[model samples]
Target: MPDRWDCVRENTEWVCKSTVVANTKEAIIILTAKEIGPEDSLAAYESHLKTPRMVPDAQGRPQKSVIKSVVSRKIAQHTWLDGLQLGSEIPSYYTRYLATVKSRLAILVTFSAHQRYFTKYSGDFFKAVNSLRIVANSDLLNPSATSSLELGGSEQIGPGQVPGFGSPLQVPDLDTLPSEPSGAPRNQQLLFLIGIIIAVAGIFIFLKRK
Candidate 1:
């Protein structure tokens, strides 16, 4: 008769073996089986229990006996490698996963951090992380970077460039433009006043005549 056994770890199934003693470790597993030769014998009482009568071979052993086995295991013990801790200081790969939630969720969680880091770095943090999502299989870290808005361009005036908005561009004021010299403009001013008086007198005369 052949013996069968199974190995399991955590919630995952590991391997199945026959006639082997198996040992599992954090990073590796070992399996061993003894190949009983035909001449290997059990106690006489133990052999008597078998359906067929068994005789010891020339070496005074069992007539036939053999064992075969196999071993299989995972390459890594834990999902994370490099001995890094989880939570606040999680790995980059894991962070990318977190970003893949809805855009609102991403903003709720990553917006402040993104602003703080990118303000100093001057590069699009979400864009870089989104690019990483193309390779990282985890969807939890893939985030949309579309909410960012562009302020303005060269031709269009920016808020900072507008008047009273800290713009260095100097705009000439209408009230500051030069006026004709006051002394030399006296005759012209008198003529302008006389013309207004004559026009008013003509209007009164025309109304009386009507």
Candidate 2:
């Protein structure tokens, strides 16, 4: 076996394979020890092996054993795999389990990307995922302060301005007006009335004389 060969054992059967290849970027490798029994003849042929080598005979012919093991050795090379140590009372397949979870999450997030089904809640969920990513990389809860709540726009009002539900501005009280009079000056009003009366009186006198 090559130095890069990862070993997996299941049910007394061991197979050596590479967990991953840097140049090829392949993550899985399948190896066949040998072929046995008529049931696995096709698999044996596919593996380019003639007869089963590791296992012994059953009642009559050798029983074909099908064993599957993950490529753990090469998987350990990945940084993500370092958290998933095998056989330490913790789950032995944490790496594979997390990969499955991430895959499912990606699919769900992708499906939610369609516009028709994406509501405000969906947007919130997407934002939450983004926040998680930011939290993983940074110390701040909010990565951008400008992206906070909007202020002073068409959708918002100035400070101390209460929005009216049914009217543009609240109606003012009748007594709330200033005590000072707002009409013309008192002398100007008297002069205007006097001018009107004199004009009428002059017209009447002229008619009587005529």
Best by TM-score: 2
Candidate 1: where are CA atoms >4 Å away? 1-98, 101-118, 122-127, 134-210
Best by lDDT: 2
Instruction: List model 1 lDDT by residue over 43-112, tens digit each.
Output: 2212211222222333444432111111121111211001110111111101111111111121101111
Task: Name the lDDT of candidate 2.
Answer: 0.21
Error of 1 at 90 (Å): 15
lDDT (0 to 1) per candidate? 0.19, 0.21
What are the runs in model 2 whose C-alpha is more than 4 Å off?
12-25, 32-35, 39-210
Quote the positional error of residue 132 for candidate 2 in Å: 48
